[model samples]
Each structure stands twice: as structure tokens, then as C-alpha cells.
Target: MLHLQVFTFNPFSENTYLIYNDNQECWIVDPGMINEQECQELFSFIESHQLQPQAIINTHAHIDHILGVDVVAQRYNIPFYLHELEMPVLNNAANTARMFGFEYAGVQTKPGFLSEQHLLRLGNDPVTVLLVPGHSPGSIAFYYEKGDWVISGDALFAGSIGRTDLLLGDHPTLIHSIKTQLLPLPAQTAVHSGHGPSTTIGQELNSNPFLN
Candidate 1:
């Protein structure tokens, strides 16, 4: 079984996930640790558990979601992964933060593109990539087939959906992606969002105002 550890960090309260299997190999998804303390906390856990990082991934490249990508990637010497389309979003993170009067150190590690052809695996587990863009041009979800859960980043929320007011966001496209790509999953499948508590596909399908 894969174990998922969540860390809420930075002003955005973004949820950073560390997923690992029994073999002690793990993948870091969206490291949001902002300061050295936060970064150390993450590293300490990995060291304490003797977890070997396999790769670093992002569901999207929003500033809040990638604050620590640079630090983590460099520290672990791991490859970073994100959808090719999100490069624009990632590239714009620094400017976006400045506009919001926030500081961003930016990601220095070279990132590999995530596509269906490029499989993401941890030990014996296979993680499927779902192209559920709309929150951002290249937003994606990591679906763990064994757990029947998806790490949905700012895409579908508990009682609401992602806001489309930001740059490159489109309401119609967001809705369509949720309906066609996410809602079709098993009702029992858990939805582990980027900013809030977890919910199930059935819960969102039945109650999410945007989807219903």
C-alpha cells in the first residue's frame, strides 16, 4: 500500500504531498515549503524515515504550489515533472507573485514534461496522469489506481470548483474537464484537493454547486 503524507505550507495553505510505498521510495508532489524551517521539516521526515525520493512533480505551477520546488529538487537531486503546457504558468510565477506583492524565489531545477506516454511509478505502483486542465492551462491530476484516489490540484473542491478568474482560466473548460475527466471516476474514489480537506467523487458529484 502507498502512504500519503500531507503538509500544509506557506500563506496559501497549499497542500504538499509525499507519497511512498513499502519499498521506501517516494515521490514529492508540489513542495510548498516556503522558508528554511519548513523545508527542513520536510527533509527531516524523509531522513527519519529513510525515504528515497524518486521524483518531484507538480499538478500545476502556481506560485503557492511550487514555492519549494527549487530547494527540494536541488536537495534531493531529483527530476521535477509537470505537464509541458504549464511551463508558461511556471515561467510567469515570479511576475505573478510580484503583482500580488508576494516574494517568490522561483524554481531553478529543470523540469521534465509529464505526458501519458511518460509513466509515473513508485516501486510497484503505477500512477496514472489525468489531463484535467482548466484551473490552469496544464493542470493535471495524479491518480493512484490502487487507492482509488486522485490528487486533484485546485481543480474540483468539496462544495465548489476552482475559480476561473485567474489568468488562463476558463469557466466552461474547467467545468467540462471536471465532468468528463474527473466526475466519471468511481464514486468511492477519494478527491485529495490542493487546498482543502479530502472528499469523495460521489460527494462532489452530489453536492458541489459548480458541478451539480
Candidate 2:
């Protein structure tokens, strides 16, 4: 069975996920722990669970989603993974922090990138990459088909959808990706998003105003 620990961090309350399978391997997704205590809490959870994280992944490169990429990467000695187009956003996290009137670590950097790897080991359970880039230019969601759940960043939400007002955002593209990539999944498929609550594809299709 795959085990998960979700931490709501930062002012935005970005959801950072730690996933592990029965093998005691784990992966951290969107390490947005904006403060030192949050970071410690995150690491502490991993240690407490005896999880050995094998990979670090970001659903997108928005500042809120990636504020602690550098810290997590450095601490775990793992290569960070993000879509190719988020380089600009990754490079400007500090600027975003400044704009948000928050302090930045000043060491924010993009240390890695992702391609369609056959398997992403989240503690022995393999997750497949699904390119659902609608929230941002390079936004992508990861899916573990075997597990019947997806980590759907901002591209999707419980009842609303991601706003396309930011850089490299496009409404039409997001709609297309959602229709083609997400809705096609089994109706009962679970969607774990970056914020708010989790919902199933069927529930969204039946009730989401934005999706309709």
C-alpha cells in the first residue's frame, strides 16, 4: 500500500506531499515549506516514518509551490524535478517572495528537470508522469495509475479551477488538457490537489462549475 503525509505549509498553505509505499521509500512533492520550522517538521515526519525518499518532484514552478526546493534538494541530496518551461519561474522565486512581501532564502535555484520517465519511485511504488500543463506553461501532474490517484497541482481543484492570469498561463490550453488528460480517467479516480480539498474526477465533472 502507498502511504502519504500531506503538510499544509507557507502563507498560501501550499500542500506538500510525502508518499511512500510498503518498501519504506518515499518521494516529496512540492516542498513549499516557507519557514525553517515547517522544513524541520517535514523532515521530522520522514524520519519518524522511517521513509527514505528517493525522488523530489514539483507539480509546477510557481513561487508558492517551490519555495523550499533548494533546501529540500540540498538536504536530501536528490535531484529536483519540474517541467522544462518553469525555469523562468524557478529563477524568479526570490522576486516573487519580494513581491509577496515575504522573505526569501536567497538561494532559490533550479537544480533538476523532468522527462517522461517510466517510473518515479515514491518508496517503491512507481508513479507515471501525466503532462497536464494548464495552470502554468510547464505545469504537470503526476499519476499513479495503479494507485488510482493523481497529484494534480493547480491545473485542477475541488470545485474551481486554476486562474490563468499569470505568466505563461492560458485558459484554452488548460481546458483542453483537462478534457483530454484528466476527465478521461476513471470517474472514481482520486485527485489530490495543491490546495483546498481532494475530489474525484466524477465529482468534478458532475459538480465543478468551472469544469462545466
RMSD of each: 1.1, 1.7
Per-candidate TM-score against the hidden true structure: 0.97, 0.93
lDDT per residue for candidate 1 within 1-212, as digits (tens), equals 78899998998889999999999999999999989999988999998999999999899998889999988888888999999999888988889899879877578888999974355778878888999889999999998878999999999888888878777988999999999889999999999999989999999988888876
| Whole-model lDDT values for every prediction | 0.89, 0.82
Poorly placed runs, candidate 2 (over 4 Å): 105-110, 116-118
Clashes found in each candidate (C-alpha, N, C closer than 3 A): 0, 2
Global lDDT for candidate 2? 0.82
What's the lDDT for residue 148 in model 1?
A: 91
What C-alpha lDDT, on a 0 to 100 scale, does residue 127 get in candidate 1?
85
TM-score of model number 2: 0.93
Maximum-TM-score candidate: 1
Candidate 1, residue 172: CA error in Å?
0.7
